[model samples]
Target: MRRVLALLLLLALPALAADRPPRSGLDYATPGVRAMQADDFANPGMLWVQEGLALWDRPGGMGGTSCASCHGRIEGFAGIAYPRRDPRDPDKLMNLETRIEKCRLDNMGAPPYGYESRELVALTAAVRHQARGRPVAVVEDADAIAAGEKEFRQRRGALDLACAQCHEANAGKKLRDETISEGQTNGFPAYRLRWQGVGSLHRRFQVCNQAVAAEPYPLGSQEYIALEWYLAKRGAGLLVETPAVRQ
Candidate 1:
């Protein structure tokens, strides 16, 4: 009975293709989620941004210097060219989260935050928030982008689903109560009602992979970073939506 009800609910959802015409995951969101994101006061994700700013000013590391001391305000720093080819090691890719970890250990002489750690999420949110309204640029690394594109196209795991299956071909189609999307990353570090918390893009990526019965990669892995880079490129011209709310 429960399974039948669930199936009915999925089918009952309206066929909605591309929720908002102008673009944005916001267009696809439920009314409650859209309203939550519209109001800064009500958006629970703001708490994490607030926490991120706090951590920015707090002193850490063996030498005791805050992130603010080095970079000042974090605004205008996120431009969506992340998962860049690492300067020290061209083979390695660095996303906002991984870059933060690197800075903590190398520049600040501080311990790196654990993956998906509160501190890491806060910092990443704060950084992305700075980039709000900025356009995502094309990646310079040809090889990496090519590799990511290949991954995006290939079917994987038990479901044999590719990232493009829904995001590219079936985007805007109804999936149960929600609509499939072009899979933009502009609104990352977003507040998800399901999570009841702010989560990184990689976190959401993991969820998608699991949903498809694919073996998900570890957070911050090269695979994820590559995928993020490609996704960012695909989402070029979209505004960053850090701390945005999602259903």
Candidate 2:
């Protein structure tokens, strides 16, 4: 009987150890992340910023008129106050990138770039550059807020983990070498050293879902767009850092 009890205790020890939560560390929030929030304008990624600026002024596709021709100086147009509920379509909200595509199609008389395209990336970076100092303030009208919150809390994936499980509950905890952040969207279109390219929040989400063994949703899918709207609102006070910012 004594031998059996000891064997049972030994068998349960590994399970107990596996249940322990991850640890937190300063390394999780990299210096690049801090620099991005403090002063992204001075970051080396601003070279893309210049390219985006030029792209904004250049004509493309069937549209002879540049974004500059209609919107005038992009420097005066800020993009931080976005992800707002569209008055015409209350069921849908518009993020800065979405609004830019709409303007490109309607006002600039050009074909809209596909989501994650270089043209869209450049244009978004250029437009976001104008809002360098502005604090992010995505709208949180009742319906939009409710929908966003639902997406944030819902779990989907083979791992059975929701974004909230890591970003909200275990935020600051370490999973291997990387520390988890609050999953803020302030430093978007950021150049992650790991990725070797500038990418959008949606791209990051896809990577994260894959890491947890979740099926990745298509780019520009309604689910991702909704998630973007939610994340933008969640990081309302953070500043916009565009282009390929080093992570």
Write model 2 residue lDDT over 125-229, tens digit each, in one string: 677767765676576676666676787777888898888778866677787887777677766766676776566667888998888899988765557777777
Cα displacement (angstroms), candidate 1, residue 32, comes to: 1.7
Every candidate's lDDT = 0.83, 0.69
Off by over 4 Å in 2: 1-28, 32-44, 61-63, 243-246
In terms of lDDT, the best-performing candidate is 1
| Model 1 spans > 4 angstroms off | 1-22, 76-80
Q: Write the per-residue lDDT of candidate 1 for residues 133-247, one digit (tens) a residue.
A: 7776566777787778787877988989998778876777998878987788889989889998989988998999998999899999998888888877767678887888987
| Residue 95 error, candidate 1, Å | 0.3
